[model samples]
Target chain A: MDFELIAESLPRLAEGIDETLLLAGSSLVIGFVLAVPIALLNLSNNGTVRTLSSGYVYIFRSTPLLVQIFLIYYGSGQFRAELQAVGLWFLFRESWFCAILALTLNTAAYTSQIIRGGLQSVPWGQIEAARSIGMPGFMAFRRLIFPIAIRQALPAYGNEIILMVKSTSLASTITILEITAIAKKIISATYQPVEVFLIAGAIYLSLNFIVTRAIMLVEFWLTPHLRVDRRIPPVVRRTPAPVPAP
Target chain B: MELSYLGWGDAGWGDEFARGALMTFAVATCAFLLSLVFGTIFAAFKLSSNLLLRAVADVYTTILRGIPELLVIYLIFFGGGQLLQTIALGLFGYDGYIDLPVFGVGTLCIGLSAGAYSTEVIRGAVLAIPRGQIEAARAIGMNQGQRFWRILVPQSARYALPGLGNVWQFALKDTSLISIVGLVEIMRTAALGSGSTKQPFTFFITAFLIFLVLAWLSQRVFLRAEAWANRGVRSA
Candidate 1:
């Protein structure tokens, strides 16, 4: 109900959206890059590769991201001396780097699973057809398998993206001044936790809404053939133009 | 740095960590139960004939699902107390502090979020139940309550067990967030221990192991439950 306070806080909270987006966007990009190979490894016939990637996914998925963030951010402090010796302390020392690193790893685990499901769902008959046409292995995978798998995975990956966006708020606990952090700051300043949180929640909800709509657009684009209009025939009128001509 | 720091009794945080684990279990259980109740109600709303009820359920799930759990927790913890105090002042002319317990707020927040997810799962499970069975029950002159208890509940529960297992895992992990509100859960215990001992890696790694064990054990339990639930049923 404190209109003036909420009005003053809106602009400051808006600034944090950039930080939130950057954290989520970069981590998602990196996580996807990491997920592809892991998903492939998960589908591999080689037992060792499959086990290793499965283990990676299990460890990351089973643990909470908060502990991972703390472990990376604070745990690294315990290794500062050795990291500095290796010239890697610079990366470990920044909360942003640690936050993104944790987020990337956690997301990669989930994404790999999504990608694996997609890959598995790619019909073996399609791959066989590509092989029968003399398409090379890598080319067949890239052109035939990968495209189908990605389209199949897009919806689940969209959910993952929303999750990662919401998760960026946890970085606030690590001293990252994202929206939640900014909201907390405002709450302390004005003693209006309810108003501040309402604004912050609305911002997050809108961001997620946009993300969901964007993903749905991509889903629609990816599967145009699945659209009902695409399948239905257009209606035509015969002999109606003769009267106009007369 | 000494191993004794993790030992039980006067020298270590072993007792506190154990107690914290118990608290985590307690919180997760309460929240999970609350989530199931909320989820069932909302799922019914979603499946109801009324447009208004369905829309209300949709909005509830969407908004809760969209926001971060941490912010929700903070909102309830801080804002809930403020609202209660204001209401007390207005209605009873009382000018006293109203403190909502952190455990209640934490459970409510986690329950609300988890309920959104559980709504989807339960709805899916309900939809998975074949209509023919319900029809058969009615043809046999079974009452609504008997049909519900005998056919609908068991079948939907079988279908929902796996999803509910995932929700339980989520709830367990989410209990960690409660530490931010000063609850003496495992995460908070680890934080306290690490802060006092200046051994962040040690305590956190301990916490990680504890969570991993819980996740592993829960997975086993769910697997067993799934097997039990599917007893005598043919697998596709």
Candidate 2:
């Protein structure tokens, strides 16, 4: 409705994209790292190990991320003295740190489950085949199991990345100048809610589009076997030149 | 942790927290049902013969699913009222300010966003129903309505339950975003309490526990529903 307003606000909102990417990218990286061990623990043979990991995943997954964010950010204020005693007050004092920490832990809970599913879906025979080849336990797990599981997991994990990106908007609640936050600031100030949000929404859509495309590229690379070899055409048996009927 | 902060009556926030939890549940229930309506309609649109209807449905789900829930709430909160007021003023010549209630806006935004997710799930469920089943029902002289009610609904409901359960959980968690728009849901209640008490950990942890309870209870409910839907079916 306000073309001029939209043109003016574009750059202001664009500035937030860097912060958004930083928050989401960092949280996703940490979440992925944390999820691997948690996933493995969930699949562990030891009952206690499995319970503890699944409990961690369950508790995190069950609760809302906003509460988790609040618990880490403002919640730490209640324990300032204790955190100070442990010399960890500095970390707790920073809102950005808390935001990333909350997002990381939350995403890990979801990602670990995805990873667990991927790991579980790996063919049992493959592990046995690795064992038959005299592959060491860790070696087999590292090379064979991890690769196959990652490939199996990529599609689901792609959805998780989109989720994580969308979730970085939560950081705005804590004063981080992410795209959503900046958009909010602009809209509230200018009273051009439709114009401001349309731009912001477009930014998010493009971000997610890029993310999904990257995931698809990874999936394509990983699943070479699923792709047909266009370089090599399928062979068709030559038809007999002379037909007896003819 | 200060136990007195959680005490009931005028002494503490126990009553408010309970009310807040109820509010959260109420909002989630309304939003989830609203979403089912949106989902079914959009699913039908996607499945219909009209290309324009299919394109509209696709655009709805794609854009809705892509953007953050917060933005949707904000857009509805800030932009939706303005749009409605313009229409009112133009058609009815009403000049009064149309202040959209936060609860309605929040629930609508959440429902619309959740509906996009539900559309895909329901569509998938409907598509999963075997084509031959419909053909056989047709051969047996069932009308479109009969075939849809008897043959399609039951089977798709079974298929849709698990996905719908996930959507419900998503809708539940998303209610927290409504707090940003000043709705007094669980997150808002916790925030108010924490700010006043200066004991953020106690109040937020309480909020988290309440959510955990809600999620756990609903999960069991979903499992039961899934079982109910799967009646007479043999599992491998």
Candidate 3:
């Protein structure tokens, strides 16, 4: 453990955090946008629609994300003509676009499942009550169902976010110089794997810690009903001593 | 577009991919089995009354789970050999440039990660076992070893199956990371074929399909095992 080396490399590695955060943040946002509809499709009344959506989830979930990244990045080179004709070639040509495309697709699959689980967990009785009140189906879903489901799903989605942050490391293989990629470069140069990786690992762990803490805050905010009034301590119950005569 | 590019022998990359797939399977299997060992040990540590043991297990799992799996592989690949060399030199005054086989490195890294997960699974399974059942075994004058073997192992194993299946899928996927370190697994083979043949789509898609098949098959195997484990137990 060379302390000096760590001190020197810390600044360099810190620079890469922007890329890491950008990659994870953008994909999560885009993936969430994609996930909402896929989740609905997953829970559709029609079997064909449900199966089609689920098949997308299954394939993405089953295969390694690295392969998926490669299939988009390197794999797109083979279809250059078609992609050019469709005007997707420009996006495919850049590693950033390919990486984000792969990541967005991957996270969408996982997020849909998490959303589906959240949707399933929303009580049927609540939905029925909304229906009885003559709330339109869309209104019921928007007002009664979506909020409760999202609150239920937030914790799991937090886990998924952490996983996505970690998944961003795979982007390094495609030449995106994120934190892990920077760590690899430093280690290769310094021949000090243990130290460089330890630093890199610390960065990731701390990033995850911050993300989780933020999610916890979000969870706290979202579930006001669940949040006990911690500001006021519970009143201690007391039994008055038996009075001789009252 | 050239179908024969995947044909067997000198004509194509079929044989290479097959061999690579086999290597991937072997690595995943070995890693998974190794993880079970680490999981049991750490789970015991975690479940122990001793504070030090519990802290050790907690740190192990948290650190392993927090970092990216790719970094874990890099740490082990680059750090492990040096550690081994140091030990050998310290013990016998015999030191050479000792390189760990990529296979062992791949297995060890994946095993360590999967073990962190399995420790939670196994610990949960242990906790799920009814306390009264253990007390009854004690009441019957069963020895500790006898109770563990007869009651604890079987019951906790049954409970741990589903979680362990997820861990196995992760280990299987983690093997692809080994290709980054030149393990020559399916991922590596695909990368090579793609680079050589200039058919990136073909090779990468094949790799993806191969993984899909492996994942599907293992999922079935896990389901069957779960059924077998839960046999004669009431569904309700």
Candidate 4:
């Protein structure tokens, strides 16, 4: 490894970091919003909706993300005239939108499954209690059901986030000047793949470390009862000597 | 005015596509087997009493799981070449031109990622074995080798079937990424056909269907194995 070359390339690689973060962060946020409803549809009793949702998930999840990106970027361009006529070509003109669209759809398929599993694990008693309290179905689901499911789903979702962050490397294939793209350029120019990739790996490790810690904090905050109450272990609700019939 | 590029005749890509599918299967099988070996070693390390060995296993799994498959492949393909060349110079005392073949590099990358996931599955299965079973073997005067082969290995293999099946599917799909390193797998072949024929939709759809078939077939095989393994047990 050439220390001088690595030192020289640090700033340029750092510039790539911003684009990398933008690609991953934007796709993750958008993917999460889209996945929730898809998850619900997937779990619905309606056969048609369930089949359609599951098929969407299957197709997206089964194929590699690279192919999906290529299809969107190049395959869809085959219809540029038709898309342009409908005023959608403006969005499709840039590689950024294509990368985001592909990543969003792919991540959504995965996150929806994670979320569906979470919703399925919600205890039936909680929903029954909500109904007994005269709470409306939508109100009960929003307040009681969604909260518990989110907590259970947070760990898997955190894994998904890390996967997405690493996946942003694919954006480089679309000519996006993300970290990997920049690293590739640096290597071609200088013939130093090992050093550049090591730096890139370090960058990813640090970013994922921060993201994992943030999610852990969120999980802790959401389930305060699960945390050990420093004051006592289990605090066991003492009967206080039967209280003399008080 | 023509859709003959996808036809099966001399001018069509029918031949190329078929060859690509064959390559995908070969690479996937090789990589899967390599992963099983790597995974078994790492799983054993994770279960070992030495803290340093356990830590090495942990770090290996973390880096493999934490990074993208694409990045890992790139690292293996490009960095692998450089590392090999360096070692060749140092150890062999001679080096003219050193480079890892595309297939070698690709298999290494895929196997590396697959092994990380398999380590978890194998470790889980090993843990799932009832502690008493091992104790019983020991009490019966079975040696370590006998106990491992007769009891631990068979039992863990049965329990690990489902998770290993999923990993196989993952390995199958991830083979597509190796196309970047010029392996001519389904994905790369589709890409080449699309670019040359300018019919991206036709080839991409073909690639997707091939993977779907592989996934379905692998799932069936694993399910059959699971049933066979559970033969003596009472079903609930």
Candidate 5:
């Protein structure tokens, strides 16, 4: 209800939004790149490859991302000497790197599943037709399968993107000055938890709204054939009226 | 630094970790139950003919689903008390430091989040029920309550089981976030143990393993429940 407090905090919170977007955007890109190979492993003909991919997915999905973050960030301290020897200690020491690493790993697990589902949904007949046309296996997959699979997976991937955005808030616990962290800082400073959180919530809500809309737009573009023209005139009924005598 | 740090003794944190795991289960159960209650109500509202009620449900699910669970917890934990104080002042004019316990607030926050997802699951399950089955029950002179209990509830349960299982897992994982508000659940126990012992790796790895065990066990239970629910039904 304190308009002045919310107004004063808005500028500070904007920077937090930038950090949030950075964290989410970078992780999503990395996660998607990682997911492709994992998804392929999931759909592999070899049992070991499939099982290994699924095991990775299960481990990530079963544990909370917060725990994973803590394990990588804090747990890595135990191996500081080994990590330093391998030149990886500096990355683990930075909270931002740890957050991104955790997020990417988590999202890769879920995204791989989504991608696998999409890949499986591609009809066998389509691949058969591609093969009949003498297309190479890799070319057929690259040109014919991948496009359809990605289109099929777009909606679920959009949901994953939104989740990743929301998850960036957890980075605050590790001292990342993301949106939620800034809001918490403001609340601590001004003692107006309600106002600051409301403002923060609105920012998140609007950001998600835009993301949802953008996803819908992409979906619309991907499936133009599915959209029906509502303005088209209905077909005229040609049945003759019943006789008055009847 | 030593494995004995995890042993059950005066110096080790074994007892604390065990207690934390129990508390985590308790919170997850309470929150899941609360979520089902909220979900049923909102799902009903969504399926109703009333436009206003449907809009309210839509807004509730959208806002809750979009926001991070961490932010939601912080808002409720910090603002819930203030809101309660304002209500007390306006109604009974009694204003003192009214404290809402951490457990209650943590359950409420996670419950609200879980409810949003559950609402969709329940609504979809209800919609999946065949319309003719309900109509047949009505034709047989069964009342609304009987029809709901005998026909709708059983059928929906079978369809809702898998989605509910996923929600349960989500609630269990989300309890980790409650540690931010100082709830001594598994995550918090690990944090405290790590900070005190200066062996962050050991404590956190222990916490992760505990969670994996819980998740694995619960998954088996849910799978069994799903099988039980599907018994005698022909598979497509």
Candidate 6:
């Protein structure tokens, strides 16, 4: 209700943008990279590989991300000596890295399904045609299959991105000073929960809106043929239609 | 070390973990049922002839579904108690701190969010009901209530089963978020046990296994329901 209070807190909340972007960006990139192999494995010709990949997706997808975050962050700390012996403790020691790892793993599970759906939707005829022309296995996939699958997956992937952005708010619980963390801090200081959260919510909405628009643009660019037909102006086309002589 | 901590006696947290699992089941079941009621009402409103009623239902579904569940829980946890106190005072002319039980709070939070998702699922199912069937019922001169019970609700339930199952699973998984409000569900119990014993791997892995079991069993039940619902429907 206090517009002035929210107006005043904008700068402090803005400071958290870098951390928020960092959290979301790292998780999205790593999650996408991790998802590709899992997705491919899920669709593998080998039954064992397919089962293993599907099992991974099932386990990760069924559990809550909050549990995963705690398990990685605090749970990994329980194995300090062992991890230190392997020189991997440093990775888990930092809250940010742990947050990223958890989010990446979680999103990878979901994204693998999305990607697998996309990959599955590619018709067999296209692959057959490519093979008929003697397109190599890798070449055909790279040229024909991957592009089509990515286009199919883009919209779902965009939803995953927004989900991840929202998921990053969990990092605030682990002391990662993202926008939500900053909002919490501001609220504790100002004792104005509504204003702080309102401003923070606006930030999230704007960020999500921008990301959604960008993904849509990418989708548009990727499928130039799918765009609205601009071949002829309406006025020119509407002028007494020239009927073909029967 | 892990075994002792989770041992089935006073020396460990076996009882607490078991109780937490029970509480999770209790809360989820209550929330699921509540959401079903809430969903049916909202869905009926959505399908109602009144434009204003439809708009109200639409707005409820949109805001609840669009926002993250965590924010919803936070708002409820912080504001719910005060709201209850205000209501209590208005109704009974009594003013005291109204303590909402963790079960009540967690179930209500989960129910509110689940109801939003369920409203859409139920609405879609109702809309999918063939117009001819309703017309036939009308021609048969059945009362409004009878037509709804005998013809519409049953058919809609069959159609809505799969989507409602999805919403149920979503609700189950989301119950873990209620740990923040101190519901002491499986996730919270595991977190607490892991923190106390410093055996994170064991407790978390155990929690994960429990969830997998619940999810797998629920999916099987839903699949059974789906099969039963679709019985006698021929596919070419």
* Ranking of predictions according to lDDT: 3, 5, 1, 2, 4, 6
Candidate topping DockQ: 2
Candidate 3 has a DockQ of 0.87
lDDT per residue (tens digit) for residues B1-236 in model 1: 45677899878989988998889888989999999999999999999999999999999999999999998899999999889989999999998887788888889999999999999999999999989999999999999999988998899989999999999999999999999989999999999999998889889988888888888888999999999999969988
- Against the true two-chain complex, what DockQ does each candidate achieve? 0.85, 0.89, 0.87, 0.65, 0.78, 0.50
Top candidate on lDDT is 3
Positional deviation of B41 in candidate 5, in angstroms? 0.4
Candidate lDDT scores, in order, read: 0.93, 0.93, 0.94, 0.88, 0.94, 0.85
Q: Comparing candidate 5 with candidate 6, which one achieves the higher DockQ?
A: 5
* TM-score against native, each model: 0.96, 0.95, 0.95, 0.93, 0.95, 0.88
Model 5 earns a TM-score of 0.95
Worst lDDT window (10 residues) for model 3 chain A? Answer: A225-234
Which regions of candidate 6 are displaced past 4 Å? A222-246, B45-51, B82-98
Docking class of 1: high
**Deviation (Å) of B206 in candidate 1:** 0.7
The interface RMSD value for candidate 2 stands at 0.6
Candidate 1: true contacts recovered, fraction:
0.79
Per-residue C-alpha lDDT of model 3 across residues B144-229, encoded as one tens digit per residue: 99999999999998999999999999999999999999999999999999999999999999999999999999999999999999
Q: Residue A40 in model 6: shift from native, Å? A: 1.3
| DockQ computed for model 6 against the true two-chain complex using alpha carbons | 0.50
Query: Residue A157's C-alpha lDDT in candidate 3?
Result: 97
Worst 10 residues of 1 chain A by lDDT: A237-246
DockQ (model 5, Cα)? 0.78
Clashes of each: 0, 0, 0, 0, 0, 0
